[model samples]
Target chain A: MSDSRVSSVIQEWASPFPGQAHTMHPVTSGQAESTGQLAQMEMMPYGQSQLMMREGGEDRVAEQMMGMSYLSYSSSCIGNAPSAASTNHHHQSHGNNEQDFSHFLLPTLRAPLTKRSLSKDSAEYRLRRERNNVAVRKSRDKARRRIQLTQQRAMQLQEENQKLQMRIGQLTQELDTLKHILSQRHMPGSEEGAAGESRI
Target chain B: MSDSRVSSVIQEWASPFPGQAHTMHPVTSGQAESTGQLAQMEMMPYGQSQLMMREGGEDRVAEQMMGMSYLSYSSSCIGNAPSAASTNHHHQSHGNNEQDFSHFLLPTLRAPLTKRSLSKDSAEYRLRRERNNVAVRKSRDKARRRIQLTQQRAMQLQEENQKLQMRIGQLTQELDTLKHILSQRHMPGSEEGAAGESRI
Candidate 1:
């Protein structure tokens, strides 16, 4: 469990491998593989993902990167806020069909909440707090990574853009030189324009 | 409240102005201004934000885009899991200082939760569910917009790349024609070699 947690932290932070700093870092092989896959998955470039989306004949890569599982609300709740409210009211009246309810429902109902024990001292509150703490961390980490990855991808594209522009400039200069040589040689009255020499 | 909600929804989704779709849309002037600001804020390109980050001597743009407010956990809870656990234990001892506590604590502990109404039928549960529903929508919309923005950036860069490549090709072909003309004209023995017309 501890190794998995460490591995997940590395993946979430996208931190450089700690093994580089500490040569003897004790990581299980499974932990290493999982972390490696997550890093690879996130580090995939935006252009490459678009290509993959086209090649696969679907947007699975884009969907996966968007964290589809976390965002997958029922279609009923997606765009229609009015419908979502009505759905909530529907559940309020027919509470028996609670299994289909979303994150709004408590995950486990081992025991009902009691006002007397609702104080922070109670075990239930502690359990709930612990669970929420984990959730908050997960959500925050996910958002932070998304922002970081977007920035990284943007930087990559910017560098590529610069390189392509430079290439165009170089080609343009070369073409200009070639055209200057041709103009010098093809001057009808200046047949002896220094044979093959052009200032350009 | 409803107008604010709709304006916020527009900002979160970064959807095109609805006024474009409904000519008679009833948007208050203030709502229109707020939505316009948010749209402008989010539509700022990644490169422009990076430049702003540099000029401002801070990463305010990046921080804002990352939704720093939502993710700002106390330092105690951020990275040090063990410290976070201990912090929770400390909170358990000092329940009086609940304000410093994060989302784990109920936002408003009205009369305390009692076991009887802990079921879904309670007004407390309904209120909590509604608040959570709003939060869920806000978080999902923010994430979806982030993904869309990143993809939009990638597409922009890809198109730029293609244009640059095409320019290079044109330059290269032009250069080749120039060189062919120069060679044809500079041929010492071929003085009448189509002086200005080399089939190029």
Candidate 2:
């Protein structure tokens, strides 16, 4: 149940195959509640052709990420609140030139940046963050489920394969026994002779 | 492959499962050559329990993303160049109050903003973006390969299952035939006589 134990298991389960060098960055922002972020990032590398354990570790990681997101979101909002002058500066700096638009003739319908800062402090930014967070969570859960299903399917198939091999051996042995009996009944110069031969 | 055809296939391959309402946002920034960004974004939704064709379409999409990154890097650099005054403003605006650091006493080592703006125009920003683009590409390709391998494994298992079932049927038939022959030899009043009954 401890974070360290879960984190270590996750690290092993998700280590990249040799030579790939797929470095999964842990969530390193020093927040005590940020245990889940590392797991989320770590899981990204499990898409490699390695067999990862989807047992209890993934469930714990998922919970951790869910808890971490709330804290991270709140902290980010506090740190990134834009001031009035900074918002004004951002608006004045982004200018429009029709000449720059000539190359890509799409409709320029977005209103000027002055009307809304779209800063971390803004309502729009928070809304977008909320939506993105939900999307990311959904995506992660779907991925975990897929991996679990694949593992189950693989195990089922392997069992089936073994059963098939055993059945093939059984059939071969029975066929041999039947052929031997027929041969015994139809011996070249035995007591049952021609009658048994006709039957065979 | 034309962009439209690939896009249609991708859209079908990655449509969210019923009731999930997972709306995947396409790359809407209209630049004519920005074909790959949509595919990249679309692939994220494929982690759901659906069979996606990692055929010609994926290869095209990967190429498109690689191509698009160069253009995006170039365009973003041009648009986000920081001004001298803005750099100064950013430095002055970000204050260092020791009180704010009391809650989380980590080393605050990043220098003043004026030392390096880290804007889209900055070399540091470009380097980071370049690294991120490569990491994303690697991650995407690995995911695609995993999906393909899963599909292949599933098919192989199904085929093996069928073969095993056929073998089981064949063995059952052979066992039945041998039993019938033995029964005929040991009948109550068969012409084979008491000698056959002794052998049985």
Candidate 3:
């Protein structure tokens, strides 16, 4: 017979494609097409994933990005109502039981989408959308942190203003007291002052 | 004698010069010159009351400024060791008892200096020192307030830095988890994945 070791390699190779195909089964082409938001999501501000240039121009990263995108997409579609209302209406009538299957289908969905890898115009567009979404999320986080910094700085400035105002008050009071004491000496009250100083 | 009212006015006029002389008695030309600082203090930053040009040339402001300055000076000199160390040493040894008389004579000490009222060189000098001291104090307060504002802003920025760092930690954790989930799908053993999704 043929080499046992060689047979093993062939079996390993043969099984992966189906497993991957299984992962992409959830969104079907029809589902992603229905969500109006998915196409618009491609323009996210991270430039493009074409610049990633992985070794061998590998489609592995693209496949991985696709799996993650569809996983997020299905989950989003399940909970999203604003746009998914028309397309998901059929699934809604199937009740909570159908939702459980959709949820379970999540992991298997990844295998199929990733197995196709990043091929075709539509597939390439999906990969870009996923990449842009991630970039947008990171940029939003940076902006949120900047806002927090400005707010905190404002609070600290207010604190310093309060402290300076209080110091001005104390200085004013001190100057006034010093004037009162000097005036007493310069006035007709010098005799009383001299006696007081002697006491000191 | 003339009528009591006329007699009273005559007596009042008669008594004034001696009263004035008595008032001028404490300062003879000698005592002011004795204290070297009175002359030196005049050279202070305000450039003397000669510059006072407020309406009416009314040294009322200068006088008020003079009054305020001397007041602060005496009070500062009282417990202050730096300049007072030499001028006040005699009073210091008086065991706080004679110091009472010296304190009473505080006006006598200044009358010799300010009696000329920005007229004599020494009096002009005293006014300048007082103004300069007030200016210096006000300037110092402004600087102190500015320093406080800067320090507070720095603290606010540091607080923002700390918050950003914490957020970065959370984002990194999220990215790692997302990457790990993606890597798992890319690797082998994907059959269990399809089976799991099917259960849903």
Candidate 4:
């Protein structure tokens, strides 16, 4: 947008996030219109977590992060049914890394999915299943809120950012006006007027 | 709101934007949690803006930021019938700043609200009014998009903040686990067992 209000938004973002000044190598400025376009492109989400909102917000991010971190862990156990074979294979594949994050992950992942086995339908298993479901829901809700908090956090940062930018703009205008006034005062005719006044 | 998801939304806000790491002068962290809560109160407009959305991603944020900024500026000027008296008062109120950002704002503000006086009913006046109406729509749309961009910028920031926190959480967990493992190994006999073979 060529409008001033729109242009300001574009400019604020085209500049670096606060305190990242050292990282933001300054480039030549564009015409106001193009600058706005530049900011829109740069800030657009390239492929940010497509958290299926229908599913949930933070939970999806957690799921994705968890899935990626433990892909080998989840995938390996997917068919192996948490048997000793899968655990052995998991350790074997990860022989060098001392991480057993998967070791903790495997039992938790396998438990809730509970393998549609006949034994899973038993009252004891159902009760256990209910408890697990409740826990999962609780964790998911926590995750969702966490995600929301982070989002709010993001908002505060931006507000602070906008406020700072506004301050910068105001200062720049003030400086410009002061410079203009000083220049006018020193103009040749103005200098003569001042000298005449002093003589009087 | 106490649902884990909502509480997290609240908590995330309650905490300070990360990297104020100095004042986080760690006074047992609960008070900070409440502080984060106060921030949440400020940032809830931000969260409501979040809309638990999983679809069409970041474009939405750009859309929102553009919307809000324009809303305030636009709503303020709406329907007051930009009269000569109001314009005179506006200038007089602005007294000798040697700046007239409002000079730029005036024509754009008035054209759409063409006064209903018989003088404006002339064909030339009607034609001018039509052109002004189109320009007004264009400017409004641009203003709307600019506001959306600011809001989106806020949203993106929150997302980044969340991601950073998640990484911190993961790293802390890893550190704790390593400490536990190291404690176990140094428990005296565990070292030989670890050294004898890579049996682990």
Top-TM-score structure, candidate number? 2
Per-residue CA lDDT of candidate 3, range B40-158, in tens? 21121322223221111100110110001000111112221111111211111223232123335666463333222321123333345445644653454443333344345556665
Q: Could you tell which candidate, 3 or 4, scores higher by lDDT?
A: 4
Worst 10 residues of 2 chain A by lDDT: A57-66
Predictions in order: lDDT: 0.35, 0.36, 0.29, 0.31
Query: Model 1: which docking level applies?
Result: incorrect
The digit string of per-residue lDDT tens for model 2 on B1-200 reads 11111112122212234232222222221121111111122222345533333222111100010011001111111122121112222212233321232334333443222233343333444455445654664465556555555556766897888878876876676666666666676566663521221111
Q: Rank the candidates by lDDT, best first.
A: 2, 1, 4, 3
For candidate 2, report its TM-score.
0.40
Give fnat for candidate 1: 0.13
Evaluated at residue A133, the lDDT of candidate 2 is 53
Q: Where in model 4 is the C-alpha error above 4 Å?
A: A1-116, A192-200, B1-152, B155-200
Which residues of candidate 1, in runs, are more than 4 Å off? A1-147, A192-200, B1-150, B189-200
Assess each model's interface with DockQ, reporting 2 decimals per model: 0.06, 0.08, 0.00, 0.02
The estimated TM-scores of all candidates read: 0.33, 0.40, 0.21, 0.23
Put down candidate 1 lDDT per residue, B1-200, tens digits, no spaces.
Answer: 11111111122212334233222212211122111111122333433222111111111111000001111122221111111111211111232332422335574542222221322323443455445644653454454545556756766887888888887777776666666666666576664543332333
Position B184, candidate 4: lDDT: 52
Q: Which lDDT value does model 3 have at B83?
A: 15
Q: For the second chain of model 4, what is the TM-score against the true structure's chain B?
A: 0.32
Per-structure clash totals for the candidates: 6, 0, 20, 27
lDDT preference between candidates 1 and 4, better one: 1
- Which DockQ-derived CAPRI band holds candidate 2? incorrect
TM-score for chain A, candidates 1 onward in order? 0.35, 0.41, 0.35, 0.33
